[model samples]
Target: MKHFATALLCGLTLAWISTVTADQKPNVLIITVDDMSCDSVGAFGCELAETTPTIDALAASGMRFHYAHVQVGNCFPSRNVMFSGRYPHNTGVEGFYQVRDTQYAHLVDAMKDAGYYVAIRGKVTHSTPYQPYAWDQDLTIIDGQKQHIKNADSYYRSTKLGIQSAAEANKPFCINVNVSDPHKPFYAMSSKGQVVKDDNVPSKIFTADEVPIPGFLFDHPDVRKELAHYYSSVRRADDCVAAVLKALHEAGNEKDTVVFFLSDHGMPLPFAKTALWHHSTRTPWIVRWPGVTTAGSVDRQHMISAVDLMPTLLDILDLPAPNAFDGSSFKPLLEGGAQPGRDVVYKVYNENSGGNRSPMRSVETKRFGYIFNPWSDGKRIFKTATQGTMSYRAMRTVASSDPVVAARLQHFNHNVLEEFYDYQADPDALHNLIDDPQYQKEIEELRAEMRRFMVETNDPILAAFDKRHDLAAVSAYVDQVQAESDARRARKRTNKSPQQDDSLFRLVVPKQVQAGQAVLVKIRHTLPKAMAEQQFHVTLKNGDGGRVERIVKTASGDGVLEIEFDVPANLKTKSVVVSAFVGPEYGKHHLHRTKGGIAVTQP
Candidate 1:
């Protein structure tokens, strides 16, 4: 993706250098990491045992901003805003939609036009091309099991490759190494707590008790174990960061290069990665500008977003900040001077198509967070998130009888009230104060403030955002595309004996079913040509309630089982089971008829 199709010259030759301020042009380096939260760093008051020496060293040399945030909470949208210097809505990519270049030039193009040898080393935004015209070179990567760039070194190598090319051209370079660390499967490179692949991967997993599993989770042991696994990945990320800095030092660019280190967004846990809440969207920004920003300085006063970064770099380099940017330049603050920044920085999301869920947009300040849900009314229909290998998703595979965690999972899936948080009293945002009488004034104030931001930024949400199905519709449509992809794969597999197969039984709901409506369960057997007809009992049970019973099972076709019954009128969300116990239950695969995430909305 890094080969430029053609060169766009800003004509920054040493001869042309006489036309610009000679002392102001500084080389820029942007390093972005994956799902990392404030909890992993010591600077954020996280009590971690391992040393984050590289990140700590970087912070010690420059400034760390405690209140830095992202324009959106999710990865694709955050990258969109970061690249365009605009809001996610304005970029026409509320979530993972393609970025339209006509609306905004990428930061690389802008910086390149200003005569900088700009090159991208890691996951470049898909909204733009990996063509030669866009970047000087893109370095190849060895993907981790989870299919993202593994660590800072994965990116550093790419950047190093780009640096070699830049040297051949006699160019001063602006390099961006987009690192992927600290994201998930939660556990690093393995299923168990063991590090199977890279010896660099952390071996010991963190537990919820070890790291404060953000309150949004049920505060359960399982969730804590998940948190520990996530922190283990963070420890490995720190080591990777150390490797990158060492490369810069070895290359003799440590002092001259302006190194900016940060994650695109927060963690991949509940209410963190995809949501617009502070824990998800807030970025941990640390910049080391050798002679400019003071060493070991922590700035908590200013509110800055990733979108503000490009313009800030432009300003500090004595380049004109593009008028199209929605963010203000913060060169003064970076240069060791102080000026008043915004009281608030707005964040939003159209949807998280990856998680197969709803749309959410949140506005946050030092003290408050207000989310606008376009699907709060529950009238929307979306694809079930549990369609794949995600454990949280696979758990829904047997939601019936798994009431506690299932309901919590569904609460997130279905989402809750129009979210409003008092960061002061409910920093973890456990209790939503959106409709609370005591917080009415605060909610209204935030609403008005967000409205002004929308107007000023020409946000498309200003027109589309409502107490309707805006977010759900957009996300579901994308899910429809994904579902089709899954469908294609599903069709290819010949299920000769799915009944006797090792994997559990699977079923499909052809259409939406509602409360008190008739639900039909159809099961098929994939047997070798002769072993088609098999006797199997189909059972139905409410996964959440204690009720368990067999549904109508008048054994039918040579390779099929079908059951139809009137669903309970009062049931809001429930799963049906079709398990057949053969030979005293020593060996039998559990076949499940799962719900297809349909909301039977009240009139």
Candidate 2:
């Protein structure tokens, strides 16, 4: 009896210790706004009143950064950088398409491994590299009603539900609450200038007369009207912020939770979104950690990039990071310490949502900025989401009559080879100093910095940037990239099996097959001599989550191989993907791979 009692006491002690350890780990709450510029928030230098009362209050109660930037200006790539801690080039998420099976771990996976209950409210597809991720709970829908992305009240309910769900799961929560606002279809006013009736409305609406125009845009009446609607949407996003914080407080996790707030990028307007300008990448970053950060403090010395988000969060959670990360942890800066080599930030813009490529790279310091645009050969017209806005239309209308406006329009359409800006004096980036001999020395220094960064990061455009002075070299590189893009588009159009470059690999499958059908997959590859002596593996996966794998010997260094897979009778999806791998064994390190997909017809 005494032995039993002692054992019971020991078990109880260990259980208590475990509980305490879990409780000590702070909860993580990341709130992101869509298409919001740094200057939209009052705490981040917006002179406008009440544009972001809740966000401003949160900033006053925490630490706000003055020099924070995201790696990309588009939504999917930007958020991917924040969650993956890698640049777009490294993650293969340069645009809006899905990148499956990355080598590095995602932030959601890391948080789940650390015993946290992870959830997200909106932007589910945008935040992850691939679709159908295993999140603990998607707070976008609870019971029966869908959580409206633009409805402030829906955010309140969703956040409350997330907190409660985490409590029931008996684990700390890591919730991402992405608020959609200020992007497009902004809060509409009536034709008579009165607020329209809608289920989704901003807490406060502003008039065009009172709206402050962005420095990058001219003060035209149409521009001011659009800015008014944009600011109104910003106010609604702030309401969402207020709702999320209230949920945290009501759940009694305020002091024990660390809250992070920022935008995916700048506003979706001309000279902002989808560009590599200062306003395009600068974000309004705020953090609230109860014991670590001083209230109402602002950090202007260190330039924090979104790529550091994953590493810093992992550090804060006391979790192990992956073997490699492009970004370092900024935990020291959060603790009121300093970090070296934070004086400059590198920014990139690859493709847009429509798969249009306008590759750009820039390096920025507090006072100066330099951009390299190999795509801008004075002939190619730039296309972006902002070109669809009223502001762009208004500028087009006046350009024919006004030389200044005409010049601006011309520069916007066809960018020069290089651009140098004294951003400190001209925050709007209106004046280009590329031809000014007085700033040539500074430009050269920035060019060297950019080249070093590109070389170290192994940027695909390194060759182009190095030969930027040689138009023929630049043209050749651009043509090669364009061909690749065209090939991708052709693949989509044909819906046929893919053939790799140099005729080294090809995969062919049936155009359509029915349920329970025997599907034939054909592969032709020129394997290396070493691999020819080893085993080749093939995996056939149906869209319904069914997988079949096979292994065979590589008969020759160059030949064709055929395999068969049985589609499950209960298949529920409309497609299947086949992957061929050459390696020592199946599920091992692979030397090469080729993948293709086929259509599945219903029985």
Candidate 3:
């Protein structure tokens, strides 16, 4: 009897210890705001009052990082970097596509493996390979009517459901609540098809006059109007943040949860979102960890990247980080320790949302910023998401009237190859100091640092810097490599079965060819024997002025079609679109179309 009682007591003690250890593990809640700049948050110093009361309160109750940046400025890549703790190049996820390899361990997967219930509430498609990163409870709805967290009520309900589900599972939770506020097509619209005031947006909607304009933009009337709508969206995003935090408290998980609040990237404006400028990659980062992080503490000394988020979270949870991660844990910095030799952060820009190639890389320090624009050969005009906005249209209208605005507009449209900015003196990055002799030494040092980083990371575009003037060659190389990758993926998917194989067709041309020069247009395809000898019509249309050039090409014995055409000497456009079709005579099927255009530079 005595031996049995002793054994029972030991078992009970072990069970109690296990329960305590599980309870000690903190829950994690990440609230991500889309297209929100660091300066827009009230806690980060928005001049406009009440712009972000909820976010401000969160900051005051936690730690705020003043100089945190994302590895890439775009949405998908930035979020991927945060989740994978790797650079875009490393993960092969520079755009909206998923990483071809499933070997990589995701943060949510890691959390789930470590016995935590994981959930993602909004913006489901922003991260790729939905199967590998599948959550225990996915509350994201993509019915086209409302894809993301629509309003405060929906956010509150979704968050509460997530917490409750985790509690029912009897596991600690890690939830990602992506709010799609302030992205585009702002809350309210007017009769003139302009963004106007609406009561449903926010309680205190900012007016055009009350909006604080960034130094990069001209203070035009239309710009202010667009900004007013953006501010209203920002306010709405803040309310969503408040709602999520409220849910955490009401669920009684506030004290045991580590809350993270940040933007995927910067605001969706010119020189901010798609470009490698100051405003492009900077994000507002706030962390609230009860008893671990000091309340109201601010960290301005460390320059952290979105890539570090995964490793840092793992460290905070006392879990081991994967060896594949490029970023190390910044947990020491959060615990009042310094991260030595962490002054500079690197950034990259590949293709935009439209799949247009405008490769850029940069090295940003606390006081200086250097940018390398590989596509800027004086002919390739950079077009991105900002082009569709009303503010850009407004700037174009006033360019002829205002010379300063005209110069700014011209520079924004046609950027030079290299740019250097003293961020301390000019935070807007308006002045290009690359040619300034006073900063020659600084420029060289930054360039060396950038080159070293590229080499260390094995950046595929590092070779393009040497051929900066030859935009066409660089574009061709990138396209060919991507085509080969796609073909390999397709081959694997079809298991090399000829009957099931639909040939991959890619139009390969130099991104930028000199006017009046003979350019080779290669149609690379993997057609089966049945379609190998089929003839196709190839059309090259000027993107700027819509000049068309057509030619009939017969596929060679090995399924390769090569043709040469003289680029029109008097071509008014800077880029050309190459497309092919196998039509009514062969079959009612389209061959393939180039995702983007080929550049045509001046001779």
lDDT top scorer:
2
Best by TM-score: 2
lDDT of 2: 0.80
lDDT of 3 by residue, 359-444 (tens): 78999999899998866766768878888887888889999899998998888888888999999899899899999999999999
Q: Which consecutive 10 residues in model 3 have the weakest lDDT in total?
A: 11-20
How far off is model 1, as Cα RMSD? 19.8
Give candidate 2 misplaced runs (Cα > 4 Å). 1-23, 189-197, 493-603
Model 1, position 10, has a per-residue lDDT of: 14
CA lDDT of each candidate? 0.60, 0.80, 0.75
- In candidate 1 the C-alpha lDDT for residue 588 amounts to 32
lDDT of 3 at 187: 65
Give the alpha carbon lDDT tens digit for every residue of 9-111 in model 2.
Answer: 2331221111224447888999999999999999898978989877887887778889999989899999999999988889988887777768888988999
Ranking by TM-score: 2, 3, 1
Q: Per-residue error at 448 for model 1, in Å?
A: 0.5
lDDT per residue, candidate 1, 487-547, as tens digits? 5445534422245453323454434455566667676544344433334455444322222
Error of 2 at 469 (Å): 0.6
Q: Is candidate 1 or candidate 3 better by lDDT?
A: 3
| Model 3 misplacement above 4 A | 1-23, 129-132, 142-148, 190-193, 196-200, 466-603
